[model samples]
Target: MNRLPRPERFILVDDNEADNVFHEIMIRRAGFTGDVLIFDNGLDALAFMRQDELRVPTCIFLDINMPMLDGFEVAIQAAPLLEGRETTVLVMLTSSGSPQDRERAAQIPVISGYVTKPLAAALVRDMMSA
Candidate 1:
């Protein structure tokens, strides 16, 4: 049994439902014992984030492309909400291979890593350790 947190809180921002399930499974199998919060759109995620009552996750797996407020915009908005809180790891979880996307993700101070879609256990482990 995983002796870690019963439900390792994670924010998964993918538009695809299957992708959500896959990552959720991968995360748990990776030894993360937390609830994976799924959001299809960055604006929806951002809306929840604006709520002071919203709980920040241990990490965020953000999708670069989404309707209404893409990952870049979400990152911009999420920064202030995360102020005064501990480092909540943010990583780009997307299929986007654009050099510009990488550059943009790098520019976001809150974003710790840029991960490709279909998050694997190894990537999860690396992020957890980082």
Candidate 2:
């Protein structure tokens, strides 16, 4: 199977501090030696993404329920920023398994995947290999 190159950066946007920490650990355990950025809210993550010097081949794990802007809102706003950036992966790493949520995510062109919460090392490895 053809595998995409390893991402140069990982961004975690979620309100839960514990989840962010655990996800960061999992990413490291998955053998990711690149930068890991954690944001407690979506607005901050968007701000970082809008920076002029943002890097490519970045993976963003976004949560569905967040204050100031939900996952869908962030994804919508991020679409333009991610335009033509093929290596950039935006996955909804949410706890909600609602069919509505999944369908909503599916409608977003920029969102590449939807994963349940408590990101695991194996899952991270799979994401990297994809």
Q: What lDDT tens digits, residue by residue, belong to model 1 across residues 1-130?
A: 1112222478888788899999999998888876778888887887877763444345778888887778888888898876555635567888988899999888887776787777899767756664
lDDT score of residue 46 within candidate 1: 77
lDDT of each: 0.75, 0.87
Candidate 1 deviates by what RMSD?
A: 4.4
Give the Å shift of residue 34 in candidate 2: 1.1
Q: Write down the TM-score for model 2.
A: 0.92
Count of clashes in candidate 1: 4
lDDT, model 2, position 85: 76
Give a tens-digit lDDT track for model 2, residues 1-130. Answer: 1224578889999999999999999999999998898999998999988883555678889999999899999999999998677667889999999999999999998888899988889988886777
Q: Report lDDT (Cα) of residue 6, candidate 2.
A: 75
TM-score of each: 0.83, 0.92
- Residue 117 C-alpha lDDT in model 2: 84
lDDT of 1: 0.75
* Candidate that would win on lDDT: 2
